[model samples]
Target: MKSPSVVMLRRNLKHIARNPTSVFNAVLMPVIVMLMFVYMIGDAFNVGVNYVDYATPGLLLLAVCYGLGSVAVSVNSDMTKGVINRFKVMDVPRSAVLTGHVVASVLTNLIAVAAIIGVAFALGFNPSASFMQWLEVIGIVVLLGFATGWLTVALGLFAKTPETAGMAAIPLIMLPFFSSAIVPADKMGPGLREFAKYQPFTPIIETLRGLLAGAPAASDVLQALAWLVGIVVVGYLWAFASFTKRA
Candidate 1:
């Protein structure tokens, strides 16, 4: 027999197919940001790297961040409509519902990332790295998407309404800016550098940048993985408790 999660996955794909706008947002908004930053305002900053190259990974991550908006709204809608409660009453798996949503979100964001990469390539953003290096970078971005989706799942469960859930996600979406995404952390002031250096997004961005530039840095990779693991474990624990007790 198929696992409950597999059944839920099928349901999720159907829902996603029905509402294609959500998937469109996963691509459109991120692409707009990429164009604005890389084409419109990048040269003004003179960050010493090709603007598209620097912005590509960050914008790809932003696509994942933006995709969470839909996640929260969907969860909020389900809760408000009592759809979640009804699922709980059924013999279906508890975790499957949320996991299905997350799987859909990750896949949608991957498609968005593909569009972003296409634009990046057109803008002359080339990865001089080996095939394995490219794979490593893609793997890291996908993991980041999953970690980010998990965090949004917690927000959706805790917020009073879908609007509030989207509002709450704003901070998570903005947190990447303070990292070394657009500019080098060391180039910032001492205090800002200190904060960025320790922030979760920093190591992850650094790891990606290193891989993209074809320079493997063990410390950066380990730090990024550490942050990813920590977020997934803690976020999933909180989400599970919230779902089980309240939903």
Candidate 2:
């Protein structure tokens, strides 16, 4: 028998393939960040390495943040349209519905990352990391996609409407800008700089940059994993609890 999760995943993927705008909206911000930051004023950073190398990690994190909004919207639409309700009545595993969406969203985010990085490569973003570093980067992205994507799913579950779900996710889009996405955290004012430095995105961005830059990232990597774990625990609780009540 086909896994119920796999069935739902294929169904969600079909929706994504049909509605190409979903993918475009999910990826647009990161692509813009990569293009504008590198080509426009990359010389302004004064980072010792190539600006592309410096900026690519930040862009990848930004892509994860931006891409997850689609997860919220997708979940919200199903709930709003009574599709989730129909599934609730069926004999399928209840968790499979959310699992499918999460799996599909992660796949979609990976595609967005590849597209954004492909553009960066065309513009001369040379990666210096070995194979292990590359694996670390992919692992982080997958973990992030699941962790943050779950919260986005919760947001959709809690929202009364799909539009509200999208609006609820706006903070995620703005998070990277306030973090270390485009510029160094030290460049900000004192209080903002401190906030930026300790915030979750900053560590993830730093870890990604370090992994790809051949710089040491042990602390940053640990912190990033800690953040993802906290988010997953909280998000998973909220999502399943809310889903149970709704179902």
Candidate 3:
């Protein structure tokens, strides 16, 4: 027998294929931001390192952050349109529905990341890291995406409608700006700078930057992994409880 989660994942991917615009919508803003910052005014924002190197890590993560928008809206739509209820009434495992959304979101965002990187390369953002280094970067990004995607899933379940779910996902989209994504955290005002240093996106972005630059750091990687793990565990518990009790 095929896994319930795999079956549901295929169904959702088909739905995504039919509506390609959703993927574009999620990635558009991040792509625009990357272009604006890297091409339009990259020279204006001086933070010591080459702007492309700095911005690429943050921009890729930003795309993943915004990619949560689609997942949230889709999850909310299913709940509102009786699909989750239909699954409950059937013999399907409850967790499969959320797992399917999560897997699809990660894969979609990974593809979006690849596209973003290619565009970055076109704009002269070449990274000369080893194959394993590139793999590590991908791994970290996917882990962070899983964390954010699952949390958005729970938020979607909590929403009154798909609109609210999209709104709920806005924080993730805004996260990169507050972190060491676009600029170094030390460049901001004291308060905002301190906040940026400790936020979830900062270490993750910094870790990716370090990895891509071929000067790997351990602390940020640990911090990013810790944050991802924490988010996934909490989000999973909240989503499971909410789904079992209410949906």
RMSD of each: 1.8, 1.4, 1.4
lDDT of each: 0.81, 0.85, 0.86
The most accurate candidate by lDDT is 3
Candidate 2 runs further than 4 Å off: none
- For 189-214, candidate 2 gives per-residue lDDT tens digits of 99999989999899999988888877
What is the Å distance of residue 185 in model 1 from its true position? 2.0
The TM-score, computed over Cα atoms with residue i paired to residue i, of candidate 1 is 0.92
Output the better candidate (1/2) by lDDT: 2
Model 3, which residues run further than 4 Å from truth?
Answer: none
Candidate 2 least-lDDT 10 residues: 20-29
**Predicted candidate 1, C-alpha RMSD:** 1.8
Model 2 / residue 81 / CA error / Å: 2.3
How many clashing residue pairs appear in each of the predictions shown?
0, 0, 0
lDDT over C-alpha atoms for residue 150 of model 3: 86
